[model samples]
Target: MYVATKGGERAIEAAHQWLAEERRGDRDVPELSIAQIREQMSLAVNRVMAEGSLYDPDLAALAIKQARGDLIEAIFLIRAYRTTLPRFGASLPVETGEMAITRRVSATFKDVPGGQVLGPTFDYTHRLLDFKLAAEGTTPEAQRKSADETPAPHILDLLDRDGLMEPLETSEDTPSDLTREPLEMPADRPLRLQALARGDEGFVLSLAYSTQRGYGRTHAFVGELRIGTCAVEMEIPELGFAVEIGEVELSECETVNQFTGSKTEPAQFTRGYGLVFGQNERKSISMSLVDRALRWEELGEDNTGAPAQDAEFVLYHCDNIQATGFLEHIKLPHYVDFQSELELIRRLRREAGAEEREAAE
Candidate 1:
């Protein structure tokens, strides 16, 4: 059996210094600017903001730089920094209906009122690599018409108007923040949605995909997907009115799901909702699917034993920070434990050899 190594603080410090140098790469190249990262890597910044539950692009960009381009680390940094800031007050729930939409699409209806506005999407791109981009060549901007001034109404509202979709009741209850409180089982819809909104995007996406692949099919149809800026309002008691605090970019998705009515009620379409920090349709759509799957019990549907349907499982393992911490902790010193195992194995081998020799004699 062997003992653990002695202290290595000096070695740890040297390793960190080496890591810093490696992070910088070639000193001859100009260092990446925060502005460049904010603009060029805006998707990464959006992910940090969404996962961190803080909507400051500048801070997210700075975190991205400090994290050496690790998105999860950037999210962790933003989440840590957010806790240090003072809480002024809570803003009023955003009015998504009044959003100045930049992008809007619906799979259910091709041409609805306020036609499909395919703005700044890669959906139609041929995916061909352009060699010119490597040399800093610029492509001419696509032709565009003036944006419609009127706010585009959500397409799901039409189905709601006709009583075809599930009725959504508005409530004034404050939502519980998962970050502030300990996560408990049997989470409510608001709590589940909150967990999903900030959950690891890829993890949630995988679970959502599982649902679509007949693990717990919801037969979801994209009723509407919208990306836009909406004003955040805060009610001021002294002012006796609500005032616009600021604007935040958001992606909202509404999914129309199939629901055969139980013996007590008539058949109707159900709704699955998703709202995220920025123009992230993939995350939003996936969130909606997962949200619907988790609602199986409430909807009077039988549990299909799907991973996404398990609220406790999904919520507990969704945070990348927590997952990464536990995973990386395996790399920590376990020399004593391994040494004990090694000694036991050696003793067992020696005993088996002696037993064989005696049998031969």
Candidate 2:
């Protein structure tokens, strides 16, 4: 049982008021508008949306501002708000093949069907800070081009045609809603994917890194990485047809791993998949590696005793909100619990001393 402390209502209220003042900062400086945050700090907003499991950019920006640029706090705020909203009908699975491509690349093949579109990336840029940005310099507008009507084909499809890659099994079963359902052990692929999609970026990235370092090494190659807007459709029961709802920017990564085969099965390249909100390629790639690592059991591979391969460890600790809650709660009053521990230790020491004295006597 936990002990409760009372009579800090005034102090708590005063602290909250002070916190508000601190959040506002200097009155002389102009306040950051929600639009500015939504546009300029888009990556931060994307992180909040991904982790919070909410897709509203406006609310995400608002949460970021309210949290004073603390992304985790912002995520916590967005998640709290998300819980209060009513659930509408779910949308049909997005057709990524039909995505209006912004950026697409393949490491497995030099030249793909659509070719490589660099888009806006920091890959080639030097790490040095641009002083011009500090002076409020404006960049020239980028050259515009006509939208390509041809749909960019998935790289996996090329491998699939030759039977080089493992064929994905289709499922008519509706995936469990992780938010609503209690996370059970030996979770299905759908549930694991859901968890990884919203898992802490740092934690997931570390696990992925571990795999690369030979901890649970899966010789993985980036088959394709794409970023684009995909149309979401919802089937209205009355219309008996699916209608376009809205578009969401997504980053998808498909990794081709080393071939896995048995005497009964043909050798085929294993695959890992990751799809995340916004232009978050890093998270997408990392998620894919971790996802692949977690699939050791399904793939009939040995459990290498790696952190990423342990479903319980990954699923239990990957949630930043849950992690912070438990960690931050330690600051609360635990006087009763501490006192009990203190008494027990002291009593044991006293008993030891008494026993020693008796022996000496």
Candidate number of the best lDDT = 2
List the candidate 2 regions with Cα displacement exceeding 4 Å. Answer: 1-7, 144-149
Candidate 2: which pairs clash? none
Task: Score each candidate by Cα lDDT.
Answer: 0.89, 0.90
Q: Write the per-residue lDDT of candidate 1 for residues 105-135, one digit (tens) a residue.
A: 9999998988888987889989999788899
> How does residue 279 of candidate 2 score in lDDT?
84
Q: How close is each model in CA RMSD to the real structure?
A: 2.2, 1.8
lDDT of 2 by residue, 114-224 (tens): 888888889999999999989987977888654344689999999999989888879999999987787888898999999999989999999999999998857799999
Query: Which residue pairs come into collision in candidate 1?
Result: none
**Model 1 global lDDT (CA atoms, 0 to 1):** 0.89
